[model samples]
Target: MEPDIWGIVWLSLKVSAVAVGVCLPLAFALAWVLARGRFAGLVLLDAVVHLPLVLPPVVTGWLLLLAFGPQGPAGRWLEATLGVTFMFRWTGAALAAAVMALPLMVRAMRLSIEAVDLRLEAAAMTLGASRWRVFCTLTLPLALPGVVAGAVLGFARSLGEFGATITFVSNIPGETQTLPLAIYSALQVPGGEAVVTRLAVVSVLLSLAALVVSEVMARRMGRATHVL
Candidate 1:
């Protein structure tokens, strides 16, 4: 209803979209490695990647702050080399959301990667394709459905992310106060019941739409790969 409400919705979508975009490829690559590799300590890597899934969001945010805070090593490197900063910024919110969504995305992609027949990849290699080529033509295509599902799931999760985003970026309106933050703020005061109700409806609708779209994308990808 209010312009601020629309602004929050738009900001939420943009942050979610950017987080998913940055995380999707990394998730796919890591999923493939975990699904196929037998290297030592792989389990440790997997656990680390999935840590945010079980950890308290506030704890995750605090860890992120320690790692990317202005005095942190990464923050120093980023500031010196890339002229970039994330602390207290919307980008920090996206990072927190992305980390929170990582486990779901990786799980979907790992399942998809495992579902692909290794024999098909071998067959592709025998046809004079390099390992890279086989991955591109066989493994990746076969895992397409999972990739779409993972990306969509991550995006949807990021859209509603609050605890970590707020902890990392402090929920500044028009910057990091996304949909969930906006809803929470609305509910904090008297006489704002209507705004909160509308935001709740919006949240539900957005989540439902994400689920529907993900299913559609997965089906399309499956058909393209003849995966059923």
Candidate 2:
């Protein structure tokens, strides 16, 4: 393969990895809240969390563009306050991937959190463990499998992300052109089917590897939870 192709592969992996890292904590927090919290506007929060799943990918990308573009409110604020930017940058690609992957990550984690035995949590509290300590020591450990699965799912989703990423980051080579975008680009040119095939194969392998890892980790964690 060409060096540029390798660059695209590396960039895809980097963007997906960063996106999963960004989503993990946020996904866990949202999942826990959705699973356990009791408050007003719960339905609204859940709906918002899942909006991307139902919305067209292009629409999601457009919204991200509105919110994170140079002149956009959040974009301006982030730039001024944090000296960070996302518009047309690799970071933008990661941000787009994270947003698209959030729902799947949250759903997987939420189910895991909900599956935790409430009685066990209560027992720890009764035995003088603080809520924070229970969450850290007990809840998180038991939910580890789900967390790993969620991260893996997020990573896989990120790897395949296309419409949103291209819309937000504009598919600049070596900067924001991920595997999907690269494949899309190849499809547009004459005699580029070879390039398309190579990229498509890489994309499939990456996503498959992620799913396999998720399954293995989930099983191991389930066994560990059973032992506990």
Best by lDDT: 2
**With candidate 2 superimposed using the best TM-score fit, by how many Å does residue 140's alpha carbon deviate from the native?**
0.7
- Worst lDDT 10-window in candidate 1: 219-228
Off by over 4 Å in 2: 1-3, 222-228
**Model 1 lDDT tens row, 1-228:** 343888888888989998999998899988988998899999999999999998899999888888888988998899899988898788888899899988899999898899999888888888999998988888888888888888888988999898888887887888888989888888777778898898889999999999888777766654532222
Sequence-dependent TM-score of model 2: 0.95
lDDT of each: 0.86, 0.89
Per-residue lDDT, model 1, residue 132, is: 86
Task: Residues 121-221, candidate 2: write the lDDT tens digits.
Answer: 99999999999999999999988887887888888889999989888889899999999998888988888999988888988888788877767776765
